[model samples]
Target: WDAAYERELQTFEDIGDTGEIWFGEESMVRIIRWLERHKVPLDSSVLDIGTGNGVLLVELAKSGYMNLTGIDYSPSAIQLSERVREKEGMSNIKLKVEDFLAPSAELSGFDICIDKGTLDAISLDPDDAVGKRKQYVRSLSSVLKPEGFFLITSCNWTKEELLSEFGEGFEILEELPTPKFCFGGRIGNSVTALVFQRKKAKPSILDKLD
Candidate 1:
């Protein structure tokens, strides 16, 4: 993916900040508007996993979201994201080079976790995709505050699949609308947006035993 991004950046340096905003601008707008409609606090602490060039973080910052952090596995991606941050004059945002599937100790207790096409990229890996995705979910759950929001945008999975994957650990809050483009009467959007809240910890039977 990094190599592909490098090639893409070479071709579209004028257009792309770092060749990672594959979801397009329309989807970004829709998700941001949906968050506003749902009354997500602008001051909420946010973590954008697989942040790419940090386009999502930039958009959130432009929308007045203060506590912003972005993480990417690729060092080059983080470098480009940092460039974007500097160019945009956004000082409050933090950019880190880290793997979301195994995040660092410093990433924890965030009020909102945003996964925009990150899981889709993981699913594209043919080797152990299911196991890896499960690991990703576990790692994400670890960093989020109890009952914090997990907003995900994916083109690879439907709303049903997302809910199924996260239902064990979260409560489904809502499914945001996706723009439809029809081909041969098959009606569906290329992407899906799902909002979920991390489930609060349940009391264990061992508590009574203790």
Candidate 2:
């Protein structure tokens, strides 16, 4: 993944075609729209894990989100992301070179998190993929505060798969509908976006008395 992202940064540096915007602008825009429609707090801290070129951060900045952060394992990706921010004259978003699976202590207490395609990449990895995925999800959960919202967009997994994967501490809020096409009398969407919220702890009787 690091090598692939380094090549992506090189490609962007050499020619200026940043494939960083993974799926499409439309998909990103749709999520932004959903957040707006739901009146998601703009001041809430947002962490974009696996943020490649910081395109999503820039978009969130444009949408007036003040507390924004992005992390990627690739140093070149972080450099490109920083360059993109500089070019856009945006200083609000923090871009860090860090792995989500082994995040630093500083990468916690976020109120909202967004995953574009990082989960898909992890799922496709050949070595110990399941264990890595579990770690990734745990890391993600740790970084987010209780009741924090998580939005995930993927072309690799269906709604059922995503729902099954994230369940212990996360509750599915809704799955954003995607444009569907009829294939052999069956409907299918090429991509899926699901919103989840971390479940808050229930107060025990003793705690409630206090």
Candidate 3:
């Protein structure tokens, strides 16, 4: 991402023909519609995990969301996000340089969290990929408010894989439809978009006694 931003590219596709944003504007439209359908308030606090260029944050701001925060582990990514935010005249959106896998008290209490391709990138790490993925889930669970909404978009994992990954702390709210292709007379989607609600913690025996 640092290398990508150094080239002054606006979107992920601008860096190369990666076609990560192949869903195009329809992705953003679906996200907004889902939030509205769930009755998420316009003033709800939103955190965009691994917000590469902060494009999603800018779009949410334009759609009337008031409190928006974007974070990226790469310094260059945050710098690019800042530039984009400024260019769009969205000074109120917060951009931070922070690793999502690392624990941070300041990153907590978000009403909504969105992840786009971040988990897929993390899963590619050569060093302790399983440990890192677990850490990612823990960090995300800590930051999001109880019963908050978490929307994730991925091109790598199948719906079943994603459900297994997040099953412990979240429950499925909805699965948004994505473009499908027929392969060998079977239909499959290239992308998976899911909305999950954080599960409220159950009281321990000691707490129940109180």
Give Cα-based local distance difference scores for all models.
Answer: 0.85, 0.89, 0.86
Q: Positional deviation of 200 in candidate 2, in angstroms?
A: 0.5
TM-score (all chains, Cα) for each model: 0.90, 0.92, 0.92
State the lDDT of candidate 1 residue by residue for 1-210, as single tens digits.
Answer: 677655644544566445557578876787689778879899889999888878888899999899999998988677777777887899899999888888888899999998888899899889999999999989988999999988899999998888889978899988888788999989988889888999998879998688
Backbone clash count for every predicted candidate, in the order shown: 0, 0, 0
Model 1: residues with Cα > 4 Å off, grouped in runs: 7-20, 206-210
lDDT of 2 by residue, 14-104 (tens): 8876665887898789889988999988998999989988989999999988999999988988888887788788998999998899999
Error of 1 at 20 (Å): 4.8
Better of 1 and 2 by lDDT: 2
Superposition error at 75 for model 2 (Å): 1.1
The CA lDDT at 204 in model 3 is 98
Best by lDDT: 2
lDDT ranking of the models: 2, 3, 1
